[model samples]
Target: MENSPSVKSVAYPYGLMLAIYSILVLVLIYLMNIDQENWVIGTVNSLVTIVLYILALRTFKKKNGGFMKLKEALKVGLAIAAISGIISAVYAYIHYSFVYPEFLDMMYEKSYLDITERNMPQAQTDQALELSKMTLSPLFFATTTLILNLFFGFLISLIVGLIMKRENPAYQ
Candidate 1:
């Protein structure tokens, strides 16, 4: 195969999906004002992201003479995911900090209510609310998102790579 696939080739599809998912999430939070119960958005994003990853891997395989080793697939998949995750983290930081400052307050209030409902001591409730506020900051949120994204992305890559790996019969 003369035209071997580069990491960039895989990153392209991942980046495209990340962009679409980012826009959809921002629109959901901004224009649609659908800021809460993000499970809906998360679910959609996770499923689509996986599909995009699979497509990218298959494309890479095709370009590599229609075979991919397990190790090669794992590296490519993880790189694609890391790039996608960094892009997402940066966008999320900007979106939440500048685009929707009100989102922080809204989340804080919601958390406060949930905490209060527990009927814990007022001091504990205050502490919980304080902790939430501290953690909800843009920097912290971005850091957490980055960590979670990488964790899940690596996990997904393991499964996807195992399924996608194909040995070249001629190699043996």
Candidate 2:
């Protein structure tokens, strides 16, 4: 146990790798002029996160002598997710604030169009747009993104941990 690497040590590197991969996807979307709201992009990102979680957990388990408690797996997975989320949030803030200041406006226009397409009454449309505007801020974006990542990360890690957990024989 003392010879095994700590969870943080294993998680940090994988977390950074995930963050970089996520950022690269974002950059690709931006450069390709693709809609940022694309569902496919989100799906791909989610898949990548799952894969990274598996890799990180597996690496930790192997290093720990092929033994990993559910709690230990959870801890490593959550740590990786937290690290990636924090970095991604910061990047998003920067991207929206300076790299592409018009992103908020673009999202607002898209929301307005969507609301209008619903054929809602003028009053209802206005109310919806108002709510959308409130949520379009950079800080809000970062906060929600970080929260969602942690939420999904927790869910995925719970399942993966349940499947992959192995008790140390000596402890038994």
Candidate 3:
């Protein structure tokens, strides 16, 4: 029954899920372009990040394979997150770097001023800019994006694995 549904089919849904996530991220960015404050980009992205892991686990289950081992499930979930996150990060980097370079400057200036205005230490403002730069950098942003994805993915996979896993019970 090699042709029958198996964990092998996980590839299809996993790919589709990631594709959808990517598209959604793009739409979120577009919305941000319209109104920066209205941008819940990080939140939406983080939530979808979790969705990707859960979808991967669900697909794995649908494949009729042996119950997912915790380790294997974790690996699969993290992998999906890493790939999806990197893609989204890259897209954002390009959009900001080329399409909207001013956005970065705006964010930087706003934070710098806000911190100073609030009587916060200069170091805090500098620190915020430093962190933001790392995230805004095309290269570093992509790398951190992958790391963030893997980090969250691992946690999600662990939790989803606990819920989704099913071992065949003996009842004969």
Which residue pairs overlap in candidate 2's backbone? none
- For 42-151, candidate 2 gives per-residue lDDT tens digits of 88887888998999989998998898888888898888889989999998888778877787998899898999899998999889999999899888988986898788
Q: Which consecutive 10 residues in model 2 have the weakest lDDT in total?
A: 1-10
Alpha carbon lDDT at 87, candidate 2: 95
- Give TM-scores for every candidate, taking all chains together and pairing residue i with residue i: 0.84, 0.89, 0.69
Per-residue lDDT of candidate 3, residues 41-90 (tens digit) = 66776687667677778767665455565655766776676556666677
Model 1 C-alpha lDDT per residue in residues 40-63, reported as the tens digit of each score = 776887788788778877888888
Worst 10 residues of 3 by lDDT: 1-10
Q: Show where candidate 3 strays beyond 4 Å.
A: 1-16, 31-49, 120-136, 168-172
The residue ranges of model 2 lying beyond 4 angstroms of the native Cα positions read 1-4, 117-123
TM-score of 1: 0.84
- Model 2 global lDDT (CA atoms, 0 to 1): 0.86
Q: Of the pair 1 and 3, which is ahead by TM-score?
A: 1
- Candidate 2 residue 49 C-alpha distance from true site, Å: 1.5
